[model samples]
Target: MNEKVVVIYSGGMDSFTVLNRALKDGKQVYALSFDYGQRHVKELACAAKVCEELNVPHKVVDISAINQLLAGSSLTDDIEIPEGHYEEESMKSTVVPNRNMILLSLAVGYAVSVEASQVYYGAHSGDHAIYPDCRPEFVLKMNDVCKIANYDAVEIFSPYLEVSKTAILTDGLAMGLDYSNTWTCYNGREHACGKCGACVERLEAFRDNNTTDPLTYE
Candidate 1:
């Protein structure tokens, strides 16, 4: 690819894989993470660390306004993050409505500012079951909307959208992604609760991929 790629990173297993995948393929990477007033500022901080460690240009956008607008989720509020397996019941509590859309919109703007035409994300199909915004149809629609909304110069690419967490983990391992450097807990604490929806998903991904999590959890 001749054009540069900017990633919408969240410092979770998914976005870390997306960032690594782009870099492994020799794409010039500019990692974009958000300080969106989320409950877990730890994840954003992790994103900054990983970006620096990987020698990628990383910028944090202040989107507290957007988070304020969408505040029903446990990820952004005092509500407890659901624990257990990543199933329909457990995942629903973690959904921040239209979160991917807002994140991608900001990422597209950044990509355009940097003269980059492609933006990458890690919205996979497993998440689609819980997050309405991560679905293929929603991504396609948002891509079209962003193309027009972004002066037709910006495009979004979701490389893992059709796969499972196990599949994305396979790519992450190959790209040498430091799992310890990334954070996934929805709880805003010093340690992984090891029980939140995201934590559960991460554990399952590691198990499914026959990998191990390096982070210490309670």
Candidate 2:
């Protein structure tokens, strides 16, 4: 039997790229997205659409209560989503506390339940500065935890842990990924707010790659 892998998919550009990479690797892809009471449901919708288009099994776990319990981050709270480069200090307000950790923990359990050997996530170098959970160290430690916490060994496969966003975009383009179907705007408007940190970073990636972003911006 081919090794199966569970992808922590968010329907964002990075995670979408990771999903494609996993599919290209010939693994049975089970995508898991969380509806954690984030300010917008666009991402969830996009996730489903992407999965449907790719013919991949997808699950959206409802952990919206987590937002109420861990309120404060701009993503789950009423705070304004900051507009700046990802490296800006103000962008720290967007960090959902231990978000990747929580998501990966869930993914590990899902992987084990399905007897998958690997779990894939889209943590990249750009997120390491502000999001401690997205750093390589955290993923390595989490891999150890997964190995010990489960009867079967499940590896955390973060292919882009040290890769740049521009490089990721380049790979996605090579794979013919449709960027418009992926949602990255934190504001969750009908059109992307090009000023938000997520939007800025995505736009920068497209710019660096010398390609136009297919998504419309307000």
Candidate 3:
């Protein structure tokens, strides 16, 4: 049997790229998404669509139990979503506090269930200051931690950890990813709140890459 690779896919540009990379490398891809009381389910829906399009196995883990542990975040709360480009300061509240850790650990468990040794996440350097979990060092440490915790030789993969969001966008484009199918809003609003940190960052990256965005932005 070919090696199986699982991804912490959120149906975003970075996660989309990670999925492509795993598939292109001849691994059977399994995507793990969460319905973790997020402000919106659009991203998880998009994640399902992407997995179907790729003919990969998709798992929608109900992490609402864990999500309840989240507090003071626009993503999981009733707080207003902040709109702005990702800078050093404004992106702070966007942190879900160990969210990536929780998601990745869950993904690792899923991978082990299917005898997969590799797990992938789409965290990038662009998220370092804002999401501590996305930093390269954090990923490295998590890899080590998972190795010891699982004792099953599971290795975590993060292809974009040292790269920029623009690079992820570029890679997704090269892989023929239909970004129109992805959602990045902090709010589960009617339209892409073009002001949220994610939307703004995505818009800027696509623009910087001179790539046309497929998402509807107002």
Question: lDDT per residue, candidate 1, 1-218, as tens digits?
Answer: 55599999988878988988888778899999888788888888889888888789999888787766787888777787777766658668788787888788888888888888789988897777788888899999988887888565788899999999888888878766778888888887888999877888888889888878898898
Q: What's the lDDT for residue 20 in model 2? A: 96
The model with the greater lDDT, 1 or 2, is 2
| Residue range 1-218, candidate 2, lDDT tens digits | 67799999998999999999999889999999999888767998999999999899999999888776786899888898888988899999999888888889999999999999999989999988888999999999999988889789999999999998889999999999889889999988899999988898999999999999999988
- When summed lDDT is taken over every stretch of 10 residues in candidate 2, the lowest stretch is 63-72
lDDT of each: 0.84, 0.91, 0.83
lDDT of 2: 0.91
Ranking by lDDT: 2, 1, 3
Q: What's the true lDDT of residue 94 in model 3?
A: 71
- Give the runs in model 3 whose Cα sits over 4 Å from its true position: none
Ranking by TM-score: 2, 3, 1
- Minimum summed lDDT over a 10-residue window in model 1 is located at 82-91
Candidate 1 residue 87 Cα shift, in angstroms, is: 1.9
Candidate 3 residues 1-218, lDDT tens each?
A: 77888888887767878888888788888888888888867888888988888789898988787756788777787777776766747668777878888888888888889989999888887888688788888899999998888759788888888989898888878877777888887777778878888888888899998977887767
Per-model clash counts, in order, read 0, 0, 2
Against the true structure, candidate 2 reaches a TM-score of 0.98
* Candidate 2 local Cα displacement, residue 117, angstroms: 0.7
